[model samples]
Structures are given as C-alpha cells and as structure tokens.
Target: MSDEPDETPRLDVPVGMFEDIEDLKSQLAQLTALVEARTGGDSAETVEAVSADEEEPAGGDAEGEEEEWQYPPFILLLDPPEYDDELRGLIEWVEGVLVPGYLGEPSADAKWCHRWFEHSVAIARLHAAWLAWQELTNPVSCGNTGPSVWHRDHLDPALRELRGAAGPFAGCTKGEHRVEHRLPSLVPSAWTHEDGA
Candidate 1:
C-alpha cells in the first residue's frame, strides 16, 4: 500500500441519508403538532422531551396536574363511543394496509370474511393483534427484529385463528359472505324463561 496521499476525493456517506433524516424530522414535527392539539398546549413539550431514559421527578406528579396515558387502552376496555372510533381506525388499517400487504392470494384453505366486523371473535382478535403491531413496529423504541417478532408472535396466530377452517369465519367464502356465523351457547339464558327468572 503506497502512502502517497491519495487524491481520489472519496465520498464516505451513503446516498439518500439526508432525505431519510428529513423524513424523520417531518414525522417528529407532525407528532409534536398532534400532541399539542391533544393536550391543548399544556403538555406540548412532553412530546419533544419523550425518551426511553427520561425519569419522573421524585415528588411525583405536579400539583393540579394529572398524568396522561401515553396510548389508548385496549379496544375491548374502551367505552361505546371510544370503541366505535377505535374500531373505525382499526378497520381502516386492516382493510387499506394489512389485508392488501400481508394477506396472500385468497383460497379455500385460507378464507377471509369481507364482513369481518360482524364477527366479535374476529374483532377482538384483530384488535389485540393491531395493538401489538403498533407497539412492536415503533422504530424509535423497537429494534430491527421488532417487525419479525410482531409477525411471528402476534400476526400469524391471529390470522390462523381468523382464517383457518372451524375458526371464526367458518362458513365464510370468497364468493359469498356468511352473516349468521354464531357461537354455540353452552348455558341456557335465564331471561328467556320470563318472570325475571
């Protein structure tokens, strides 16, 4: 190796790095704005200050200040109005993103219910899976294997249950949607007997 002060004008940085950084900055800005709107300018700074290593004060929460929940609670735990709203968003993601991207070519072996919302079991399962996906796919806190973990641990099982024969969509077919897929009731209903029995 000759030590003759090479003048090749080498470029060290990878291409499109600045663009990626700019995109991240844009996302952060949008998130900050959303936080501002949600908190009504009270805890706007909290978004910018958010970090994995950040610690709360020793004195606990400040006087007259309530601590905020970072994310929405489980969909099942939400009240009617909140449940409706969250369900709408979840439907958007499931229909617009998840099905189109992850769901392979449809067949008799792997069935998908077009009217999936009608199935309570499917709703609960998909909501849980979606929540896991949101947490696992967050780039800031999650490692590179986050998506893989989500797919293996959360998504696959949910899909298997929803699409497999004898699953939630047992009678559903690609050509036709079955609206009356009902769960068997093991216990007799007391109200059905009348006289408040």
Candidate 2:
C-alpha cells in the first residue's frame, strides 16, 4: 500500500523451490564439467548449443553421405535342443509351423528336401529362420513393418528354395512313396584294384 512502485518482479513458485536451487546449480556445474572433460573442452559449448536436428548439413552434401549397409546381427537360439532332439524339433517346427504358416498348403507338385534336416546347411538355415520368426513375432521388438520385412526378406525365399522340386530333398516326397537317394561324395576313392601284371 506504499506510494513507491514495486521494483521486484513477483514469481509464482512453491515455498521450498529455492532450497533445491543450490542443489540444481551444483548438479548443472558437475554436468558441465563432465561434458568439458569428455569433449576435451574443444567447442563443447557450441556442441551443447546445437540441437540434434540442426546438426546435419542443410544441403545435398547430407544426401551424398550414404549410410553404410548394416546387416542385422545373427541371433542364435539360447538353449538349442540336443543334436537328435534338435533335428526332430527343427523338422517338426518346419513341417508343422513354418511351412504351413508361411508357404500355406504344401503342394503335391513341390517336394520338400526330406533329408534337408540332416545336413549342416539346413540346420543353419532353419536356425536363422527361427531367429527371424522370434524377432518378428515378439511384441516388444516387432514394429509396424517387421512382419512384412521378415516375410519378404527371409521366410518366402527360404521356403521357396527349400520346397523347390530340385532342392536338397529332390527325389523325396510327402506321401508314402519311397525314393532312393544319396548325396554324392567329393573325396577321391582310396581303393584301387591291383592290375594283373
């Protein structure tokens, strides 16, 4: 109610707000020191002032900088079943789940590499496929395009080649029909017949 006009600016804040102001100032000072140490004090202030969005070049130079192609890291199964059980599980999973789920109804014309599960290559491929399935189906990791990407990039091609007519199980069939087949060996034969001299 004094005639003299108030000079101090009034601020609306909690009563104890000033008590934490010193602590906040101490924290800010420590953070600034840490940043200076990490950056060697060279242009640290400039780096801090520049926003992430504003850091990029505003010209075609940015476009010219091509990002290096990065393949996703291969993730192996945590507890792969024992060899015999592994093979059985793999075959069961592929036949029961992957095949029907991804490729739809198994065609009589297309043959699955029946002996495919026996080979190391098939094991590796199936393992990769299983990992991809896990990643795409997982709620936390599966984003909007994850499923489509998995189908396009991994599932379709693998299933197609795996079920191709001339694939690993070329002569094998889903029916009871028996087909004699054996993988050709690359090593030269050690046995040589003695020539009659």
Candidate 3:
C-alpha cells in the first residue's frame, strides 16, 4: 500500500521458481543431446551437413533468425530522451560499450546476463528507497536535517515498518539490515542514539 498517486498493483514473486524449472529443462535437453551425439555416429559428410545447418541462414542477414536458434538479447528502453539520435546512441552504447565492458568473451548463445540479474531487483528497490531518503531528509550527510525539532520523528519506526512489509524471500538473511545500513555510514548520528537523547 503505497501513498503515491499511481494505482499500479505490486506483484510478489518467488526467486527460485523460474531458475529451478530452467535448470531441470537444461539438464534434460543436454542429456538427450549427448545420447544422440554418441549413438548417431556421424560420418564426415553428415558432420558437414549438421555444421551447415548450425550456421547462419542462407540470406546472410543477421537480423531475423530461424526457430532452431533463437536466443537474442532484449534491448529494453525505459523513457529515453526526446531526441531520436540520442535514442539511437543509447542503443549503440548498450551494444558496443556496455556489452563489451563485461569481462571474458561471450557469444550470443552464452552471454553473461542471467548471472548478474538475480539480485538486481532487490538492489534496485533498495536504491530507490535510499534516493527517496536523500531527497526528503535534509542534512543529507549529517546535521540537523531530518529531525528538525518539529515534525513527529517517527522516521526510524517507519523504516522498521517498511522493512517488515517488504516480504523478504526465503534464505535471505538480514534484509532489513541491508536496507537500514543504506541510510548512514560508519559514524554515529541522531538516528543511532535511542530516545533522541
């Protein structure tokens, strides 16, 4: 239940449900492929034909691929700038800059994407809350910013409530602490001391 004006409903999801299903499917497929590769006993001509079938389609156009090999990276664009050139620049940077920045060589079939995406959602939400705190709380670093002798100082209690309602997934230890530590660094502040003493 957010107080924000938007009426979008939030959907809670399990972390490992998709991963488990995918792992089972991958294992079964690989096992079947290994059995066929061993039992078929390919001759030189058969191997050449299989290799040709594995190659890019006859048209030589890389854009559209056949159903047999279809694992393309998605280019998702969130609200881009007003200029068309800038949008094209964003797409180019995603392809040239960001994709190549990752270490190790990767082909279209074996990109290092899913490995980096598991905990990304949690980090994104935590960053959003941190940004909200930074904007709303004056005295961003340290000073009499957040608690100016007036407004009901329920910030800490409110944070505690927010932590509890987030519905942390199973096997996640100290999710609240991870969220709380984003507020302040290694120094004691007004929020650290109890009773505002």
Candidate 4:
C-alpha cells in the first residue's frame, strides 16, 4: 500500500446523531442543496468530505433562505397554511412530473381520483411517493440507478395500491368523481369498560 498523498477526504458521521427525524431530514436536505448549488452537476458523490464544522453553515443558510418546515411533508401533520403551501408544490410535481411522466392510461379497473387531496389516504401515499421521487431522483445521493430504484421500490407499489380496484380511488371513475369515498373501518377496542367509578 503506497500512500502517494491520498486526495479523497472522509468523515465518520455518527449514526443517530440527530435528536429526531426532523433534525436528520433537515441536515440531509441542507447538505443536498449545498452540494447541488456548489457542484452545479450530478457528480458530487463524495458526501463524506463535509466536515462537522462545515455542517452548521449549510444548515444556517437554509434556515434563512428556505422554508422553516423541515419535517417530511406529511399531509395530516401540517396546519392549513403549511398544508396549502406544501400541497401546491406536491401538486406541481404530481401534475408536471408524476402524472405526465410516470403514469399510464387510467381505466375503470386502474382508478385515479380527480379530487385526490380530498382523500386522506391518497394524499398521504402520493406525498410519500413525491418525497421518494425527490430523494431518489437526486443524482448526488442515488446516482444513475436512482430513478430505476425509485420506480421499482417506490413507484410500483404505490401505483399498484393507488390505482388498484380496492384503493382509495376505488369508487371514482375516469370521468366521474365520487362525491364521498369512505375510509376503511378501524378495528373496535377489545377492552371492556366497567361501571362508572
């Protein structure tokens, strides 16, 4: 092993170093943005070079420039305003990218709800798919096979469930929007309550 001045830098980022999922997600998002901004192309695969000291500056800039909402864009967790803001972005991707690029013909058997946001399950699942798309499509993290992996692992299952007969859009048709789509019933509580104490 001849050491002729090794160039590639490395760091040992501790597992579970963050306080919560939000913090981890925030750091990752910041890192990805910084890499994208600096590199300008999809070649920055050496994420280990980012020193712990350098981490804060990236995150600091993100706080001022980007949205404060660091958590996963889960539909239910967000307030009305945040929901509206996030949903708008999600819809843009869904319409511009997912629907046009990914989806095939929608038929009676393979359904798609016109009013998808109204259905909670669809919103949740689609949001998850969008999130996966964002991450997997990024070249820095996933490389060339990212989209393929996303299609196989994320998109396929999501679409299968979403477009299937028993999916959230089961009642809806190609031309007609179902007025009311009922959610699956929850299992009743097994514990029995005694007389008022």
- Among the numbered candidates, top lDDT falls to 1
Task: For residues 1-197, write the lDDT of model 2, one tens digit per residue.
Answer: 89776887787899878879966875565555545554667675637644543675655354444331112323233244345555666678788887676554456555654456664555667767766875676443444566888888887777666667655455566653323453665665557555559
Over 100-166, each residue of candidate 3 has an lDDT whose tens digit, in order, gives 6532453232323222213333323333333334334544222354444212343333223323433
| Model 4 superposed RMSD (Cα) | 10.3
Write out the backbone clash pairs for model 2. Answer: 113-169
Score candidate 3 by lDDT: 0.41
> Against the unseen true structure, what C-alpha lDDT does each candidate score?
0.77, 0.59, 0.41, 0.76
**For residues 1-197, could you state the per-residue lDDT of candidate 1 as single tens digits?**
99877788787888999999987986776676555655566673555455421565555665413344426467776788988999998899899878998898767788888889888888889988888888678654354667999999999999998889878787887867775666565777876776855
Error of 4 at 187 (Å): 9.8
> Can you write out model 4's per-residue Cα lDDT over 1-197, one digit (the tens) per residue?
87765776677867776567766776686677766665563543435334433565654675554454554667778888989988988888888888888777888778887787777888888899889888888876656778999989989999999899888888888777773666546665647555567
TM-scores for all candidates: the values are 0.58, 0.44, 0.19, 0.59
Question: Which residue pairs clash within candidate 3?
Answer: none
Residue 28 displacement in candidate 3 (angstroms): 64
lDDT of 3 at 148: 42
Show model 3 residue runs off by greater than 4 Å.
1-121, 137-166, 173-197
Per-residue lDDT value at 80 in model 3: 38
Instruction: Give the better candidate number (1 or 4) by TM-score.
Output: 4
- Which residue segments of model 4 deviate by more than 4 Å? 1-69, 184-197
Residue 140 displacement (Å), model 4: 1.2
